[model samples]
Target: MHRTDNRHAPGASHNPRASQTHSGGSDTGHQSPGHQGAGHQARSVEAHRESVRELLADLAGTGRTEQLPLREALGRGLAADITAPVDLPPFANSQMDGFAVRSTDIPDGGTDLRVVAPIPAGAVAAPLQPGTAAPIMTGAMIPPGADAVVPIEKAVPDSFPRPGSTASVRLPATENGMYVRTAGSDVRAGEPALAGGTNLGPGQLGLLAALGITQVTVHRNLKVLLATTGDEVVEPGSPLEPGKIYDANGTLLEAAMRQAGLEVLRAAISTDNPEELTAMLRKHAPAVDLIVTTGGVSKGAYEVVRQAAGGQDIEFLHVAMQPGGPQGIGKFDGVPFVGFPGNPVSCLVSFEMFLRPVLSALFGAPAPRPAIRARLAEPVESPAGKHQVRRGTVLPDGTVRLEGGPGSHLVHALANSNALIHLPAGTSALAAGAEVEVWTL
Candidate 1:
C-alpha cells in the first residue's frame, strides 16, 4: 500500500469478530485548530478528500478471505493469482464438419479417396490410411494421421457418400494445419490466467468456468455500522405525526453502502437526545470496521452526534462544498467515524463524494464513476467560494439540464436526476453552452 505523509497504519490486525479498537490514524498528535472551530476557515474539497484517503490508506480491506463458488464470485476481488491447471483445448480438434485428410493426398485438380468410418464427437477415431478420407464433425478429435480438414461444402461432389457404399469422394488441394484447433493454442498449463486484485466480471468468470474452476478465494465484504439521527425523522413504515416526516437518510445511505459491496448493519433512528446517540455508538462502534451516521453534525441545538461525540476525538467542521458542507470525521472508540448532514440529499451527496472513493481505493473492486465533459443547456449561477454539486439530466445532444435549485432539501429533484454538474470553487457563473464537468450518478 502507498503511504501518505499523514496516514498511520492500524497498529495491529484484529479478527473480524474482535470488538477491541485497533490503534490507527496520524502520529503527528495534532491537526489544524481550524478543524474544530465554528466555520473559522473554508477547507477545500481536496483537503477533505485527503483526510478521507489518509484514513483509508491503511484500512484498505479486512485482509480476510473466503471460498465461494464461481456463480457467487461475481463482483468479488480475487484473493490470489489463478494459474491454469490444464491446457485449453487439451487435444487437437476439427474446426468444421468436413472431411479429415492428409495434406499429401490432394491431387492438382481433385482426387477420389476411399471414405472410411465417420468420427462423431466424443469418440476416438481410427488412423487415416494414406489414400483414404474420414468424415469428421465439428469439435471431433482429429485422426492421428490427418493434418488438415476440408469443409464438407468444399468437397467435390459436395456431400457425404452413403454409409455402406464403396464410394470415393473428391476433395480439393489443402495446406497443412488448415481449419484445425491445435492443442494448448489458447493457454498452456501452469500459465497465469488472472492476477490478484482483479474484479470478477462476466468475462473473467466465464474464463474461469471454461478453465473448469469450480471455486475461488475472494476478499470478505467490508463491514459498516450505519445510523440515522434527528428528532423530526421517523421510520418509513410508521404513521407520520404533524411535524415529523418519514426518514430517508437511513435507507438511502444503507442502499449506497450495499451497492458499493459493503455489509451494512443499520441501527434504529437516533433521536435528538445525546444520551441515546452516545449509547447507540458505544453499542455498535467497536464491533464494526467503520461507523457512518447521517444528520446531527450541522450547527443546530439538536445536533446529537456532535454533542455526544465531544469527549471522543471526533471533529465537527464545515467543508467548502455545496449540499454537504457541515461534516464530522475522526476516530471514536478507535473506529473511524463519519458524520453526514441530515437532509436526504446531503447524506447521499456526502456518501458519493467521500465514502465511495474511500471504498474504491480500499477494495479496488467497485470502479469509480465516469467523469465526462458536457455543455450547459442553460445559464446557471454558483456561489463564489464553494464547490457546487447540482443534480441534472444529461441531454442526448451532450448538454446538461439542471434539476431543482441548490437547496439540500430537494430530494424529489435528486431522485429524478441522472448526473451531477460540478462547479469548482472559483467558478461563479456559466453562460449557456459552457463546458462543464459532469459525473454520472
Candidate 2:
C-alpha cells in the first residue's frame, strides 16, 4: 500500500533490490543463512503480540456508534447506557384469573359478594361497588378501588357466572395487593435498563422489546481488508492446476474475523509479483481500518509481501513461536497491517494467539477462549528456543494427548483437536502426567 513506490505496480519491471531476501529470518524450523546475516533478531511471542496490540490501539475508544434494529443488534456491544422510557406494565394489572374486590369487604371468615361484571385482559372497568366482586382475567387492568384478587378456585363455585348475569360468590378474606402487579415494580420509568458495553443477547433483546424499544445504539463493527498471496494459491471450486492448492488462509481468516464481529473485505488472490500485491493493497487500504495478509513474509525468495513492504513503515520479523513464527506488523498507508504465515494451521494459530485476544480486549466481541490446566497424556519434546503450540484432544479425565506431530501444515490434525497445548519457550521436554496450560478451541 506504499503509494510512493510506483515501482511496485502490476506491470512495472522488478527491482533488483527486491530480490534480496527479507530480514524477517525464517519459519522453516531451522535458522536460515539469510537470517544469520540479516541482523533481524527473532522476538518473543509476547513481544510480537504486544506489537500488534499497539499497532491497532487507535481502534479502541473511537466512540463510533450505530443505530440498528433490535433483531440485528444481537451479539453487538451497547454503545451507551439504556434507560427505560416508561415503567414496566405501565399500570397495575391482574396476576390471576379471579375476581377483583376490596380486601376489607370480606369478613375474617368469609363473605358473599355480588358479581357485577367480567373484566377480561385489556378491558377498563369501573370501580368496584362496596360489596360486589368483578370477575377478571389474568393480565387485565385492575379496576379503580380494587385492592386484592380472589382466585376463581377460592370461590364457592370455582368458576365465573355467565356474562351480564347477576350472581353471588363466596370468597375468603385476602390482604391488600395480593395477586396484583403494581406499576413500576419491575423497572421504573427513566431508570437504567441496561449498562453500556453489555453484549446484546436473547435476554437483552427481550428486555428491550418489553421496554418498547424497536432499535438500539451499539458500537460499529470494525472493518478489515484481508488478502492472501502466492501464485500457487487458487480459490476453491476451480479446476486444480499443476502444483496449485485451494486458498484456505483467506476463508479461514475471514471466518475468524467475522466471528470477532469484524466486517471483512477480502481482496483477490495476489500472485508472486510484488507489484500486483502492492497495487491490490493500495486499492483497498482506504476502505478498511486494518489490513491482514497471509503468506509472503518468510525468508523465501518469492516472498512478494516482504518485497512489496520493502522501504515501507511495515516491519517483517520472526516471533519465537512454533507453527506460526514469521509475522509482519506495522502500518500500510496509515492503516494497521498484520501479515501472518502461509500454512493453514499457522495462519489460524496466528489469529488465535495474537489477533483474537487483541480484538476481545479492544472491541469486547468473540469472548475469550477458555484456558485451563490439563495433564499431559504422553511425554513430548519441543524446540529449545521457540514456543510450541500443539493440537490436542483434552480427554474427560483431564489429560490431553497430541492430535498430530508439530508440523505447520497439519490441517487434518488441527481439525480433530479440541484444544491448544501451550508449551512455553525454553521448555525442551515434558513428562507424561505433567500439568500444562491449555486453551480450549
Candidate 3:
C-alpha cells in the first residue's frame, strides 16, 4: 500500500510565497525555458531540502549494523566507538638503527662503548651490560637498562659491526629516551581509536590493521533502486537511432550515488509508458530502502513519472531553482521515492543539492562536499526568482569563471568545472570580482 506522511509531503499546495531572504524579482534571466510554468507556484529550495531530510530521517535510527572485514569496511560508517585494545607499538622500540645504550654511559665530550650482541627487529634483547651498547635495528625492542638510541650515522664507524665481533664505537652524548618509540605514545590502551559515525577510509583501515583489528562493526549501507526514464534514451555502445540519445543519466546518477557510498540497484531503462514505469518501480520497490527515478517529474504532456505516480502519493512540484526546478518526493508503495529531472546536468545538480546532503547527515558515509566562497572572474546574470547553480572553474588566484552558459543540458561544461557557483534566488546579476558561495565538486 502506498502511504503519504504529511510531514514528508511538500506538495500539499502550490505556495508561491518564495522566501524573501534571497534576492528576488521576476524569473527572467537564467531560468530554463522548458521548466517555466505560468500558473503553478514554486517552493523555496530550503523547503524542499527540509522535505527531503524529513523523508530520509528514519534511516539514521534503523540501528542496523554489520560486522565486516577491515578491507570490506572501507567507506562504511562506524557503528560504535573503537577503543585501542593494546598500546600502540606495544613496547618500547628503537626509532633508529644504531646503538641502544645508557645515556649516562656517554660523556659530555663523547665516549666509546663496547658493543654487545646485535638486536634486530622482532628480537628480544638481553639487558645491556652497564657500560656496553647494543646494535639495534629500527623497530627492535629497546634493551632493558638502555635509555637512549644513537643513530648509526652518529656512530664514529657509522655502521654496525659484524655480529659477535667485539667492537667499540665512539658515540655522542644523548638524552634519555632519545630516538625511542615508547609504548602507548601513538595511542594508549583503552583510548578511543575511532569514534562512532566515523567514515572508514584508507587511513582508518590502516590504523585498525596496525591495532591488530581484523574486523569492524559499521552501519549497513543504504540500498537504493535507481531508475532512469525517457523514450528517447538508449544504452551506450549501441547504434544511436536518429532521434535518440544515449542514456547518460543512468550512468551519471549511478556514479554519483556510488561515490556517495550508496548501494545502487540500477533498474533497466524504462520507456515513456506510465504503466511500464510503475510496474518496474513496484517490482524493485520491495528490495530497496529508497527509489530514485530520473526524467519524468515535469508537467509536460508526456510526463510518465507524474502520470504513473499521480495516485501513489508522489507530489510533483517545481522548486525555485534553475536547472533542477522540477522535483517529486513522497512514498511509492510504502517506499521512499525521489523523482529527478531527465536532463543530465539537472539530474546531477538535483542529487547534489537535495539527496547528497541528506545522505551525509543521515548515514555519515560520504562526508559533505565543502562549500566555500570565491570571487567571480566575470559578470554573470541569474534568474530573478530562482536560485542559480552554475558550473564554474576556480582560478589559481581564487576567482571562479563560468564553465558554460546556464543551460540544463550543458553536461560537457559540468565535466570541465570544479565547483558549483551559487547565486541565491533574489540575485539577478553580479559584476566580476563579486564574492559568491561555491560548492567544491
Candidate 4:
C-alpha cells in the first residue's frame, strides 16, 4: 500500500567512520553530535545501529522450532522443519495414448490381440493376461504384466488379429522405459522440503498445500510500546498556541511500526515530566518487547525523557547523521528503550536507517530496499565527516534530486521526500549530474 504523498528533502554530512579526529578543542575527544553532554560524543549511525542489531540478535536468541500446516503459513517464519510427505507420482503411469502390449508381439504377425474391458481412470483392472492388449490413456496407470505401449496409430483399430487379416504388424521400436512416469520420480519421501527460519511466502505456502497440510505455527509477533514525548506538542483539535504544533511524531511512528508488523501498545503522550514517564514505564516494561519513545532525549535543558529514564542502564547518544543526531538507548526498567529525536523528520529517519532493519532481520523478512545510484537534480554539500541520509526523489531518468535543507525541524520536507541519498563522510559538495546512492522507503 502507498502512503500519502508527504515527505522531506534531504540534508548532508560524511560517514562517521571517516576520520576519528576532529579539531574541536585542545583537550580533544571524539567529535560526537553534542547531544547529551558536550564532551560525550555520539557514535555514527552505522556504528550505533550495529550495536543495536547485536542487541536485537541477542534478544531474538534461537526460538523453539515447530511444524505447521501449509494453509496457515503465509508470512510466517518457519518454526518446525518440514519433510516431503511421500514420493511424488506414487505410481507409474502411461505417457501416451496407445495400446499396452509385449514388445515381442509387436514385431510378429500375431501382434494384434482382442481388447477386453475398458481401462478408464480410477478403476483397478486385473493384471493384463499375456498376449492380450489393453488400451491406455495418458496418465493412466500401466497395467501390471504389460511390457510396453504401442502408440494407437501403430496398430489396427477395433478387436484383435483377424483370420483373414495379416498377423504380421510393424512395431514401433523404442527403449523400455519410454512413455513411463515412474513412482517416486519427482521427489523423495524423507527429504527436507522447507528448512526452519524461512519466511513463508506464496510459493512456500503452495508447497505445503501440495503436501495437504492446513496449518502452520508461527512465532509470536514483537510487542512494542509506542509513544511520543514533548510538552510543546498538542493533541489534534486543541487550540494551537504560538509555539505548539499538533503531534505528528506519535501518529507517524505508530503507523510505521504497524507497517513493520510490530504490535503497538499505544502509550499516552508524555509532556516533559520525568516522574510520570518513569512511573508509566515501570508499570508496563514487563509486558512489552520494546519501549519506543520519541523526543526529549536531546541535550536540551528540558530533557524530560532523559530525566525520567535517569539512573537506569540507558545512555543517550547522538549519531553522526544530521537531523537525527540525538538518540538514546538504555534498558528502561527491564525492557529496552529506544529514544528517538523529537523532530518528526529525525524520528522517521532514525527508524529507516536503523531500527527497521534490525526488526526485519529478527522477523526473517528481507530488509527494506536500499536506495540506488542516480544523477543529481542540483548541487549540494555537507560537513564531510558523517554518512548523510538525505531525502530526495527520482526524476524521469531515475536520477535523485535533493528535497530540502539539513535542519532537523523540517518535518514537511522529510514528509514529502520518498528516499534518502547517502553520502560518505569526509567528502563535500557535488555539482549537478554527480552520482549518489540512495535508500528508498
Candidate 5:
C-alpha cells in the first residue's frame, strides 16, 4: 500500500474553519499565487508521506536492544539474528505412540517382537535388546539401537504391550527410519533460527520456547506521550456540562498506539490556554520518543496547539484529504510531534494514514492490513481535488456501502464501519459497481 497514485484519495473532509490560513479543503486542487510557481512545494499526499518517512528514518529504530523474558517479549521486534544453541528436538524422538525396534530385527515378512519395556512421554528408555521392542509414546526419546518405529495403530493387536509380562506387538514391515524424527531434522544447532526484524507473534514465540530460550533480545517498545487539547472536551466519567463533549480522541489514539505495540502515557486534557498547553509539552517532551496531540492545530482563535507550538519547528498544513486535513508535524524540544484534528473520526484517520505506516516501516511492529479493490454498492460524490476517505462496510458480494456523510464528527458511523473507502482526487462522483480502493480497518 506504499503507493503514490494521485488518483487515489483518502476520502475524508477537513473542517473549512481549520484550513482558512492556507487553501481551503474545497480548493485542494487550486494553486494559490504566493504558494505556486517555481518555489511551490508539492502538497500532494505522497509528498507529505515522503517527509514523514524521512523523519521516521532519522528518529526511529535507534538500534538499541533489551533482554526480556519470553513471556514479556511477545509482539516485540527481534533485535538481532538468533542462532539455535541446540538442534530442534535435540534428540531423536518418536512422532507417535508406537513400538521402537531395529528394522533388521523384524521378521522378513513382518511379524511381532518381544516387548521389553514401556517408555512414557518424558522417560528415558533403556536400550532395546536386539530381538525385543520398546513401547514409546509420542515425543519420548527413541531408545538407543532402535532405528524404526511402528505406530500403535499399525500393531497387529493394535494395543500397548505390557511393561513386565511376556508379550509381543505385531507390526507390518517398516523402513529403517520410519516414524522416527531425527535430531536436527527441523533445524541444526548453530544455525539461524530467526532473522533480525522478525515480529515475535504467537508462532515465533513458540519457536523460542521450543528452543528452551527463557530470555530474548528485542527492541524496546517506543514510548509515546499522548495529549488532547480543547476547552470543551471532558473526561468520559465526568458529568457533561452544557456545550461540553467527552474527550474521545485521547482514548482512541491511546488504544490505537498500544495495539500497534507502543507504550503510551496519556496526559490530562489541555485547556484552550496556550501557556498551559506549552507547559504540558515542555514537561513531558523529554520523557518520550514521540508526542501526539489532538485538537488545537486548526485556525480557530482558541487553537492552543497552534498558539503554543506555532513557534516550534512544526508545520501546520491542509493535506489534500477529507475529514482530517488539519495536520501538524515537526519536532519540539528534540522530540517528534504530530498534531491531529480534534474530531474523533479525524484523529483516528490521521493515525491510520500517517503514523501507523511509519511505525510499521521503522520497527516492524504492526503487520500491515490487507487492502482490497471493492466495487461501490452505491453512488457517492467527492471534492474534485482531495482524496476522500469514507467509512463503510464491505459486503459478501465484494461491494462496499458508505456508512455516513463526509463530516468528520461522525464517530458513531465510524464505529459501525470496518473499512475505509478511498475516492481518488479529480474524480467527483462514482456510481454503483465502480471499483475503488478499500483499506480494511
Candidate 6:
C-alpha cells in the first residue's frame, strides 16, 4: 500500500506531491495597523471553489481566434470546434507485419493459397483475389476479401514472398481483425475532433495533427497590465535611501505571469508613482483584459492603486485568507482590475488562491491543485478568524509538517514549500497527527 507523509523530516527531501502553486497569492491575509480581525466565516472548500468559478463567469469570454500558428498554439484555448474532414485511417490497414488472408483460409489443411501482390505501408494496394495471398507489411492496407491477418512470425515465407525482398513468414493461426485497422476506426468524419475551451497540450495537439490540421482557432492569450507602487520601494540597480527597499514584487510577479501564459512586463515602466500607476492602468486597461497592481494596494495613505481607483467599483476585501487578505477586485476603466497586497509573499499567494483559479477556468488549463486532506506531524497554533495557508511538506507516509514559521510574508519559505496546510478560521490550534487539508503549491 502507498501512503503520503506530511511530517517534517530532519532534512530536506523531495515533497511527495510535486505540486506548483497558482500565481502570486500570500497564503495569509494580513491586518494593517489599527485594524481588527473581523470574525470570518470558514466556508467549506467547495464553497471557495465555487467563488473562483463565479469570477471566471463574470469575465466576458475570451476572443475567438481568427487563425493561429500551430507552433504557438500550446496552452492556448481553442476558440471553435474542429471536425475531421475525412475518416481516420482512411482505409483498411494492417497493424502488424503479417499476411492478409480470407477468414475461411485459416485452419491447417483448410486452404493452400497462391502468392500474389505484395504491399508495404505508404504504397497503394489492390484487393486480393480469392485463394491468393498478398504479402503485407505493418500498416500495409489489407486487400479486399481478406478478413484476418496472420503474424509474419507464424507464416511460411515460401507460402507468400515479399514483392522485392526475401523476408517471409510461415502461415499459422489467422485471427479475425488481427493486426488490422479498419477505415474510420479511430474517428469518423463530421465528429468533433476538438472543441472550444480545449487547451492544446501535446496529446490534444497530436490528435489535431492526426486529423491533418495545420491551423487552429484558439482564444487570444489574456492580456494583463501590471504596476508596482510604493514611495519606499526602489527599482533594482538604483541606490536605496533609508527605510526604502528594492522592488522585488514587480519582477517576481512578471515572471509568474509569464509562467502562466499571460502577456506581462512589456510596458516601458517598472517604477512607482500613484499618478504613473493610474495612468499606466487607464491607458492599458482598454487594450488589456485585466489589470494587476501590487504594493500600493495596502491601507497606507500612499496606497497609489487604491487611491487611483477610489471612486471606481474596486472593493478591498480583506479575505479571511492569510498572507494575501489585502486584495481589491472590480472593474477599472471598463476592464477588470485586481489588486494584491504589496508584500512579495502576499502577492504570490493572492495569485495562487484567487487569480490562478479564475484564469484556469477562463483559459482552460489544469486548475491549481486544491487542499488535500492530510495528517499533521506536529502541533501548531493559529490566529482565530483567519484561514492560514502555511508552507508545509507532505510525506509519502501521509503526515504533513510545517516547512517554516507561520509568517506569511516569507518568500523563501513560500518557495521551498510544496503545499499550504489550511488552518481554518476560528481554529486556535491543532495537535500532532491531526487530519488537515493542504493546498498543493
Best by lDDT: 3
User: What is the C-alpha lDDT profile of model 5 across 1-441, one tens digit per residue?
Assistant: 222332212223334334322111222323222231233322466666666777667554546668999999888878778899899989999998989999988776888788887888878778888988888999999999999998999888989855688987777888899999999998889999998778888899999999989998887777899998877778999998876778788888999999999899999988888899899999999898889988876655566787898579887765666666667788988788888877777778878888887777666677566789999999988866666789999999999999988777777888999999988766688999999999998
Worst 10 residues of 6 by lDDT: 8-17
Candidate 6 local distance difference test against the native: 0.66
Candidate 4: misplaced stretches above 4 Å?
1-41, 61-73, 86-192, 365-367, 370-377, 431-435
- Each candidate: what lDDT? 0.77, 0.80, 0.81, 0.65, 0.77, 0.66
TM-score of model 1 (CA atoms):
0.76
Q: For model 5, where is the 10-residue window of minimal lDDT? A: 20-29
Tens-digit per-residue lDDT, 1-441, candidate 2: 001111111111112123111122234353321232233345767767767788877776646778999989988878778999999988999999999999999999999999998888878888888999999999998999998999999999999999988889999999999999999988999999998767788999999999999999887888999998877788999998876778878888898889888999999989889988888999999999899998887766677888888767887766667767777778888889998877878788899999988776655566678899999999988876677889999999999999988877777898899999998877788999999999998
**Total clashing residue pairs per candidate?**
0, 1, 2, 34, 13, 50
Error of 1 at 117 (Å): 4.1
* lDDT (tens digit, per residue) of candidate 3 on 1-441: 011122222221211112111101112235432234444456778778889999988777646778999989888888788999999989999999999999998899999999899999999889898889899999999989999999999999998899889889999999999999999999999999998888888999999999999999887888999998877778889898776778888889999999998899999989888899889999989999999998766655667788889689778777777777778899999899998877788788889999998877666688788999999999999866678899999889999999988877777898999999999877889999999999999
Question: What tens digits encode model 4's per-residue C-alpha lDDT throughout 131-229?
Answer: 666777777787887667777676655333434443433345544666777776765688887876567889888877766667765555678897777
Task: Report the C-alpha displacement of residue 427, candidate 1, in angstroms.
Answer: 4.9
RMSD (Å) per prediction: 8.5, 8.0, 6.4, 9.4, 5.0, 8.3
CA shift at 402, candidate 6, in angstroms?
4.4
Off by over 4 Å in 3: 1-47, 61-63, 231-246, 271-273, 300-302, 370-376, 384-386, 394-400, 424-441
TM-scores vs. true structure, each candidate: 0.76, 0.71, 0.82, 0.69, 0.80, 0.78
Model 6 agreement with the true structure over 1-441: per-residue lDDT tens digits: 011121111111111111122122233323321132233222322334345455445553544344777777887767777888878878889987767887666565444566666887988888777666677888888887887877766666544463665442446656678788999998888887777767788888888887788888766667788777665667789896766677777788888787777887445433445567677777777788778887555444455666788678776545555666556667887677777777777677678777776676666653346758899999988766566667888889989988887655566777777887878765678999999888876
In model 2, what lDDT does residue 68 have? 97
Q: Which ten residues in a row have the lowest lDDT in candidate 2?
A: 1-10
- Top-scoring candidate (TM-score): 3
